[model samples]
Target chain A: MTTNHNRLTIHEAHKLLKSKELSSVELTKATLERIHNLEPKVHAFTTITDELALRQAQKADEFIAAGNSNPLTGIPVLVKDNMCTKGILTTCSSKMLENFVPPYDATVVERLNGRGAVIIGKSNMDEFAMGSSTENSALFTTHNPWELSRVPGGSSGGSAAAVAAGEAIYALGSDTGGSIRQPAGFCSVTGLKPTYGRVSRYGLVAFASSLDQIGPLTQDVTDCALVLNAIAGYDTRDSTSAPQPTPDYTQCLTADIKGLKIGVPKEYFVEGIQPEVAAAIRAAITRLEELGASIEWEVSLAHTPYALAVYYIIAPSEASANLARYDGVKYGFSYSDTKNMWQAMEKTREHGFGAEVKRRIMLGTYALSAGYYDAWYLKAQKVRTLIRREFDQAFTKYDALITPTSPTVPFKIGEKMDDPLQMYLSDVCTIPVNIAGLPAISIPAGFADGLPIGMQIIGKPFAEETILKIAYAFQQATDWHMRKPNI
Target chain B: MKLSREEVLHITRLARLGLTEAEVDRLSEQLSNILEHFEVLQQADTTDVPPTAQSIDLLNVLKGDEVAASLPQSQVLVNAPRREGDFFRVRAVLE
Candidate 1:
């Protein structure tokens, strides 16, 4: 088996599988071997499904032998721990649910399994998907594959890091607030946070129900599109899933960018953005312009500064309520016999939750409390409306908005763990898109001082095709996404 | 920004978790640090801005009040750490 450490692009692997050059079992085994060798150092996975993965890979090979080949057939993909997989210990990196084994698969997992995609493992994440850095993860922190000392941004850090390290060809991640994109930027991979409701969220342990979205993190934009096709669609099980027609995302990858209107949001280029990151973003815009896409400076969103505050309030507020179900009575880790129900519940939660998780829950509870509801939660929702409206007006004139995915390059782990406020600002660029519930993608823009940076493409709701098209064009023009970290 | 240990305890109780005194002291500092970041929003003139609740302009998605089959109670409680018959076993709430 070839164990060449260079990352395999999903498209290349698919072609090889089709041509009989490589079997699904071979690929799955290779990836598992890589995980065994690298995972201890990378800390990308919380639980690696070695037995289940090999079993699924054998099944995928049987399908291929029987002449049944699909886009994801025989491909191995990692899933964020938050997405439930039947009989798998799907801990969202929280001690609270450390022993929880879900009885059913998250909608995406079901879809991937049906398509014969081998489930590699569950990636680690910030507990309840709350922090900018994976340092908040309860199980263990996932180090950036490019630089072990730096963080793979979170809360989807594990997914991003795993893909970056070639542990899997592609992976699934959730974005509540830049959880997918920021980590992708940090790990130098392609990750998309589709328009809210583009994919079903059933069985995904809720973080912020309204803001949480599941999308793909892949080596390139094309694989991101393929994964999106496999996972996205309407599901009656998820009430918020849009009943819109799913597009063939691969068809949108045409190199023709003539007359495409790409809007560069000036607000994104404000001070505090590192000079190198700013230069890379500008170069991306220049590359797009050279490819026949018309670039225009636009003032689309002015309420971006409020996105973090509003997100902290609303996400936690919803989380506080949603997490109430895990009070020692449900399917999570529970306490032993105690004097009173209250004491048991208290002990279970206190021992289960990490410091960050507890802090967010408390903040959220306070925001939604009777006296504070009007001032915090309600007010935040109203501000979210304005943020959405700003994008709605912009999409009328522009095909997509482009910006830096993160303000700076990946920072060293534990650098900002003590300063909670500084950590929140790490997702500044990616949060507004989540606030607006729009389709957005992060593609490796360029490198800065040996570290990678990512550029974000935001599109109107249901305009996933347009966003993918822009990212595809940029990926073709630049080889940034192809640069594997020399770990 | 400053948060008293009392304030941290109050919030922790509201969140339905018990905190140790040491945890409370640490959280007071952490919460205060985070709230200081919230100061950025204060400069924004949001007086007339209506708070946006959801990103999509979605109306209530209602389904007919029809019976939908649920998982068997046995299956649901199969993983419960403590269970009694069809109910999840728990410490008694009151005398």
Candidate 2:
């Protein structure tokens, strides 16, 4: 049951499963063994579905024995806790829903399981997906598999960490702002924040309904494409889910980047970028240029500076409404006997949420409140429009935008815990994509002082295939994604 | 402008969180720091800009009203922390 240190990619895993070289049970057991060994140090899982996973694997084996084969038949994948999995504990890394078990599977989870992919467990995340670092997780902080002392960037921290630590072959992560990409960068894996509606968010615990997206975190772009093929489609359950045709993402993997236009925003390369991170990103762009991809400099996203402010306002505003459902009466944790219903709700929320989650809820409530609605919420939305317009203009001229996934490498835990603003700024480069509802992916570009750095590839709405193609091209040119953490 | 203790408590209440005086004191400072950082938004010339809620230009995805399967009430409340009959139970609202 030991994980093959040289585990095959999802594409290769499917090939082996079809050829009868590997059984789903064996793959699931290997991943479970890896989780048992590494999860203590990495804190990647909020709940490991060991028993349930074995049952699913057995079922998958039965299907294969019956000569039924699908794209993801017998593959094991992890899901972020934020995405509800029916009959499993779906705590969003918050005490508020510490005991809540969802009654229905998230759209992506249903799709994954429908394709016969075994759900390994629920991964940890920021409380309600509100923080940049998983350190804000009320349940447990997911540590970077590379360096245990550092954070796996969040709120998809556990998914990124688990995949990087080889605990799971691939995982589903929900990205609002940089949740998926930042953690993917820190963990040295590949993660895609598919176009906002590319993957359905029907049962995902909402952080910001408008900005949140569900995507795959995997070992490589090819695996990402495979997972995307399984998960991305129109779902009637999610009204916002796009009705556009889903492309075969793998088809673009072998496409040459001979004439692809890659835009490098001068605003992203400003003075504050960490030297090592900037150097690694610059090296990646240079490598792309060497591969015959034309690099365009001086492309401007003039609203870049306001993206953080706009996101903070808009996300929180949506979060305020989204999180209101956890009133301690419907499900999960509730306070002990209290004087009245109001007191019970107040006590439960007060005790349930961690600091960062409470801060955002407060900011959001205030922004959406009567007096400040026009001044803050409305104003932020207007700026959000401008930001989207800017991206639209840029995309008209360039195929995709490129930037450092994060401003700096993963900082020590607790270094910026007291400064929430500083932590929010960590997502400065990655937020605009979510704001614009475009597709974005983070791939391991290179290393900075032994820590991994990620290069972000952003594409137009519903252009997830293009982003994956670009990432696949970059990955083929480098060995970064293949480099595993010593842990 | 720095946030007052009263404003901090009001915000916490609006967020449905009960904060102790000590927590309020600490949060006031943290909230003030974050607000100060956002002060730059005040200078943004959004005078005539229209508010943008969605990224895509598409809007109003309407569907025909159709019957959908509803979860059994028992299963829906299966995970409720406290339940009574078919409804989720809570602390008594009235004295």
Candidate 3:
């Protein structure tokens, strides 16, 4: 019961729960025990709701008994700490909100609760989702389950690591700049960044409003589709949410990609990519071709090289505006040892935020400052327009683009921490999709030196089904997704 | 691209952040280095391209002006660091 129940995927658990062969309470307990056992090593969660989970599981069992079950019913899932959960801590792994609990849930949490999904806990992340590694988390760093010494790629590192380690059946992660996909790649999990506005961001603590997107990190592609069906749709609460209709994503998961056109962007396969990682992705491309995806090798998005520069300017600029709410008045951390109101506010932020958070805030303030606003912020946004236009042009010629999710596999914990520039470059492959507002999925492709590698499939705006179909087909022919770390 | 100490201090003031001398010194150097990376943007030709504040095309989404249920004052003040009855307590703003 202990070993078997915790390892079951959402799809597998759904079958067991529906058949009455395994009760949700039993499943929840087993999962909770696994989380407790692994918490010391992985440090995946900021808060574990074992009591809340049991109560929710009991309700889920009653719902299942009444034949009112859904795909996520009775499923134990973890959420990244950035999303608010009513009466639960939503810290964003920052000291600024370390003791903060919200009075309302994020829209995604509400939807998951509506589906009878048992909330396991809030996972850790970089402070305000600013860095590429979980090392910036004010709480603690989440280690890659595959190798404890190596860092799990982040700021969604805790979500990816939890799913990989079977701490939760699946978890929700937000991607601003490759936060979801890069960590999913590092941990060998299946992750998707839905098209911008596909999911509501109403109660998500904003990092960069335009680029931030909430998506799933799961064990396999089928589970990804099932979770997407439960969460994706228009929300009147989030004005930016698309008014387009949400389809049953499960219908698009057929393991058949006969005539799909897949483009390989040359810019993604640049000089910095690890040799084995490139070879693994190239091999996956060949496999897709064998399974009937026509691969075009010479695709070029000329503006790709400038995405990093554009993202740094644009994300921080938006973040500076979005983060001004922590002013020591309404909620979260406050500093009392100050002379006046202004001094109190200033000291609150200075002491509450971590180094990376402060760096981004300073960078943003500088970029958006009066004299330099046009030269830095405005220029980056215009370049962003060019970058988006390039992806728009590429999508017209091909159904979707394929690339390596990250340039390399997971690195040792302290390897890239000292150099911020070096750490930012780790996400080079996955950043452009967010810049263009496209849907992208990262799936397990292969392994190098016992570490996992991932391949990314990016689709047109509101074209999640197309990318899911391709990823589903590729996942069917590979055994990489089936392999688990011996942790 | 190098930001002088005065420039860093000026930016911090605008950002409303209080920092120690050590942080100020380290940040001036680090911020300058990151800015050096942004120099590449000047090379790109974006003559007539408009700045994209958001990627999605939706604009001016209007809804009926209906008052929705609001959180109770107690619930809203539950996480406040300091509160006086219904109002949040803070250092004196008006001298």
Candidate 4:
């Protein structure tokens, strides 16, 4: 008895539920059925909660029946597996925590539950959110919904794929360097990576605590706004969270950008971008200009070339420290074959972590070592200040900046897996935003060779409203965000 | 930019990860390539700039000192790979 509820966005479903034309239970059932059918081809979810979703759906029905309907009350959602779900397996798609279930909910999870968002399952990710392609997952690889042979972008590939496949209404993903936006770009969905401290990261599995941020992946800009409204707020648990009042994100979606000043950095449009991807972004820029938003093409983010290098040094350096807790005791996997505890810990890590995770740990350890500290880690941090300053200066003249989310469209699976350096370049365009701790959103620009190309709108620190308004205008004038994959 | 075999082994020791001989050889080449990428930071001329450990400016967030509810002991130890009487059991530290 699945209905036409699978493709409804949060805004569309809200009106239907409020008018007593639909129940949350029906929407949940259809979404669960879609997951059951498409999961074999998409491989999006690591775990599917059928019983819990049904129970939550019934409660959402009750809440709506009592006339307390909010934007998210009946919406079925998916969260990346990195977020701790109480009593659910929260593996980061690594063998290290394959069976580890958390005892508490992440702050984002708690906030969503409070708003009556029905979480259907946890999505797959790169091991410890380390790589650019979902192939880094030790358990399984998530294929793009558009092309079953191609990859969904990493590390939040599963969440992006799920939303693109209509397996969920909206989903949440974490971005360290473009985990959310890159995958959403590849899968042709909308995703936002809020300003560095916009959301609390309390129960999130740490990859690089300083850079990691949690955000939403949705079907449209409207749904993205609703999901952001539910999840963005401050919490005392995370010291890095900025103590600021969150404006209603959905309130800004009504107005269009008429006289908005958008900056286009010349450095981002370099030689590496695929010709088709470049063409689509150019057309999108033209469309924005036609819609009355002025675009400046001479902005220079001079330090763009150093972002990837700095990220590699600093992210892995923080990873080496954040990942130190996975020793063979207290939780997760442990090796007990050896009698000595120290050797056992070593063996457990050797057997538990995947190659990508191990490579990062080793690289980090060497960079922070005695002779290399001043040359690598500390120098990278100083260069990070430079990159941040570039964005800070650009925002003074522009309301928002536009750039391609990734250099190229999504490639086939296993194409870049063998070359780690090539894989590292997948995040080249998106990493600088994380370094600057600014807000950005990726929306579907158009298709390139039948694959999606994403264009990002970046705003100043804590200025999520401006970017969302600009993106909403572009999305209204274009139908790119309406296209769904056939999976 | 090249990581030697001895150096790879030493770094693994510091990281407390035991890699087989084949794993060491492969990681040395890969880690060397990765390090060569980081060498560009030397050209950045960050002579007078300060290091940024965290991006946000807020710090020293202190919660109230009053006692709050903690996780139950049963839930905390539920996922332990090996447990004995509410304590995690691991291989002996000393011989």
Candidate 5:
């Protein structure tokens, strides 16, 4: 048995488990033990479902014994706390839902369970997926596994960091903005944010319902494709889920990118980018060019600079309406001390939400307010159209767009904590994809200051296969995705 | 775009949040700063563009009105903060 079995990929574990050399129970135990030992240091998981994990592991072993095992059957996976898991304490890293346990699983969770994947636990995230750094979790800060003092770019920090640290073989993260890919870049893992509506959002706690997409973060692009294959499908439960056919994503993992055109948006490579990060992105572009892909420059996303502005307006505007359900009534925490329902709801929100959540709620409320709706909310939506149109225009010429996942490597934990604008800028490169409802993947491009830098490959609407093929080709030529953090 | 204390208070009330004086003061400054960032949207010439309410090319998707079993009352009520006899118990709203 491999001593560091926790570090093995899902594909590697799949082969071992199928051959009867490794049992799912042993794999689950190793993952659990790794999580247990590192919980104090990484603070990756919010809830560890040990009993459920073991039971699921036994079921996986049975499936393997029966020779009915799939590629993901025995794999141990962690999901961001925002994705509901039946009978598990699915807190979105907030005190508001700190005790909220849903009676159902998310559609993604149901799929994972059907595949017999051992769901080890729920990873930590920004409260309600509101912020960039997991420091906004309101419960605890999830430190970067690579450098414990630095942040793992969030709100999917816990999921990305856990995969990087080998606590989980693979994890699921929801990306409204850059929640999945940015953190993956910071941690040197592969994270995929599928096109909106490609995966069912039936049970995901609503952030920005339109932009919020559940995706996979894994050690390599292959695992991302496998996990995507399992989760990408339609359901009547989510009316917005696209009825588009989900191709076998794993089939697109070929290392051939011949005769494909790649785009590099000039607006993405502006000032304030760390020098090393820029150099690595340039080097990765060169490597891709050498591999037979043509690179096109100055593909101007004219509305790029306004993405952060548009996202803040739109995401929070939806969030305000979505979060109004948490007013101390149907479920979750309540401030019962108040005498009236109105006072009670107000007090519940006052005591329950953290600073960042409160700020966004306030921002959303202000934008969607009576007098300013046209100026703020309506304008942002039109600009959002323009943003998407830019991508639509670009995809006609290019198969995919490549950019730095984050402007800089992971910064010190408290560096961007006090400054919300600086924190919001962390998602600038990754935000436009969410706004446009496109699929994008962030793969390890290279290292800077001994930290990993992620390069994003953005695809057109429902073009996850193209980006995955390009990412796979890049991974074949480089060892960045294979570089594990020494946590 | 500068928000007054009264304006902040009104917005907070609209959002159903009871922020403290300290929080309100901090938010007054922070929300103003955030709104200033949003002022850039005015520069985008979206004259011929229609607003994108939904990003996907999705339209009026209607499901059959067939009666499906709703979640059991017990499971639905299980997570309620205050419950009484299968009903969520909230403070008096009519008054």
Candidate 6:
């Protein structure tokens, strides 16, 4: 048994399991022990399923003994708390669902289990996946594994932190607006936000139904592809799930990007981007060019600047409707102190939700309210069309677009907590991809002041295979993905 | 684009949230700042452009009417905060 089995990637673990060189039980135990030691410093998980994981690992070992093991068969993974897990406490880091044990598994979780993946625990996230930093979590903040004082970028902060800290081999995170990629960038891991509708969102707790996507955060581009292959596909339960057939993602990870046309959007290199991050991204693009991929410097996405504004309006409006279901009756927190139903519901929300949740609810409510609906929600929707059209046009001339995943490196834990707009601005480069319902990946580009920077590759809708090929090639050319935090 | 205290209160009521005076005051300022940032949308020319509620080309998805196994009542009601006899219980809506 390898003592450092916790540091093994899914591909490495699979090889050991298949060759009878290691058992899933040993790998799972190593991972759980690492998680136990690091939880105090990282605060990465909301709930740890040690027993469930051991049981699943035992089953996976049996599968491997029978020579039926797959890539993720014996690998332990962490799930972001927003996804439902049968009989497991699936809190979205809000007091509202803090004790909410789901009755069934999310489609992605079901898919993971079907592939014999052992789920270790549920990682914390921003309350309702609403904030850029996990500081907004009602439970606790997840620290960046690289720097304890800095935030693991959110709302998928905990998942990214765990993967970086070697607490789990990989993790699943839902990205509404850069939730997965931003944190991955901060933590220096590889994260991919699959094209909208590429992965089923059936049991994912809704923040904004149209914008939310479930994706993988992994140690490398290949592991990201492996996790994606397991989770990506259509389901009848999710009406928006694309009916398109999923390709064997692992086959797309060929370390070759010859003759590929890549574009660098001038809009993403806006004024607020830190010079170090900009330089790292430029270096990454130059590397891609050296890899024989054609690079375009003059590509323009004219409506890119308006994505943040459009996202705030549209996401909140949809959230106001999606979150209305938490009415103290159905399946979450409730207040029974009052006799009147209305007062009880109001008090439930007041006590159950954190400040950021209330702020977003209010913002969404105001946007969708009668008089302001057209000005805010409808106008944002129109602008959303323009943003989508821009990507559509860009895809015509280029196979993919590259940008810095986060404008700045990981910030201090509480730096932007009080200033929502400043927090929102950090997602400027990533929000446009969600608005366009496109696929994007964030890979370790370089580092600045000891913190990691990520370069994002955006692809056309339903073109995950194309982006994965590009990311795999870049990752092969650079050794950044192999760097680990000292935590 | 600053919002009034009354407007903030109205939004809270519409959203079914109760807040302390301090929370309301804080939110009024914070929300106003966010809304002010959103004013950039005014500069966008969306004239004659169709609104996109969904990004992909998905219409009504029809499933067969055949009966399938559903969650048992005991399992479905397990997570309810207040329940009685397989039904989620809520406070009285009328006097």
Deviating ranges (above 4 Å) for candidate 5: none
Report DockQ per prediction, comma-separated. 0.67, 0.75, 0.86, 0.83, 0.89, 0.89
Clashing pairs in 3: none
Interface RMSD measured for model 4 = 1.1
Q: How accurate is candidate 1 locally (lDDT)?
A: 0.88
- True-vs-predicted CA distance for residue A257, candidate 3, Å: 0.8
lDDT of 1 by residue, A1-487 (tens): 4685236777888778888899888888899999999988999999999999999989998898898988799888899999999999999999888888887889999999999999989999999898988898888999998999999999999999999989888999999999999999999999999999999999899999999999999999889999999999999899899988898999999978889998998888996799999999999999999999999966657777788898888888998988888788867878775768877888888888888888888888877887778767877787787778778888888999999999999999999987777888898899888888998999999998889899999998999999899888888888998889876
For model 1 the local lDDT of residue A24 reads 85
lDDT of 1 at A476: 87
Error in Å for residue A412 of model 4: 0.7
In CAPRI terms, model 6 is classed as high
**lDDT digits (tens) for residues A1-487 of candidate 6:** 4558988999998998899999999999999998899999999999999999999999999999998888999899999999999999999999999889999999999999999999999999999999888998999999999999999999999999999999999999999999999999999999999999999999999999999999999999899989998999989999999999999998988878899999999999977999999999999999999999999987888889899999988888888889888888988999888899999989999999888888889999999999998999999999999999989988999999999999999999889877889999989989998999999999999999999899899999889989999999988888999999987
Q: TM-score of chain B, per candidate?
A: 0.89, 0.89, 0.94, 0.93, 0.90, 0.95
Off by over 4 Å in 2: none
lDDT of 3 by residue, A1-487 (tens): 5679877989999999999999899999999999999999999999999999999999999999999999999999999999999999999999999999999999999999999999999998989998777999999999999999998899999999999999999999999999999999999999999999999998999999999999999999999999999889999899999999999999998878999999999998887999999999999999999999899998998899999999988898888888889998889889988768898989999999999888888999899999999999999999999999999988888999999999999999989877888888998998889998899999999999999898999999999999999999988898899899998
For model 4, residues A317-365, the per-residue Cα lDDT tens digits are 8999988999968788888787888888899999999999999999899
TM-score between candidate 2 and the true structure: 0.98
Q: Kindly report which residue stretches of model 3 are placed more than 4 angstroms away from their true locations once superposed.
A: none
Which residue pairs in model 2 clash with each other? none
DockQ of 6: 0.89
Docking class of 2: medium
lDDT for position A439 in model 2: 92
Give model 2's DockQ, 2 decimals. 0.75
Query: What does the interface RMSD come to for each candidate?
Result: 1.6, 1.3, 0.9, 1.1, 0.8, 0.8
CAPRI grade of model 4? high
Residue A352, candidate 1: how far off, in angstroms?
Answer: 0.5
TM agreement with the true structure for every prediction: 0.97, 0.98, 0.99, 0.98, 0.99, 0.99
Model 2 alpha-carbon miss at residue A196, Å: 1.1
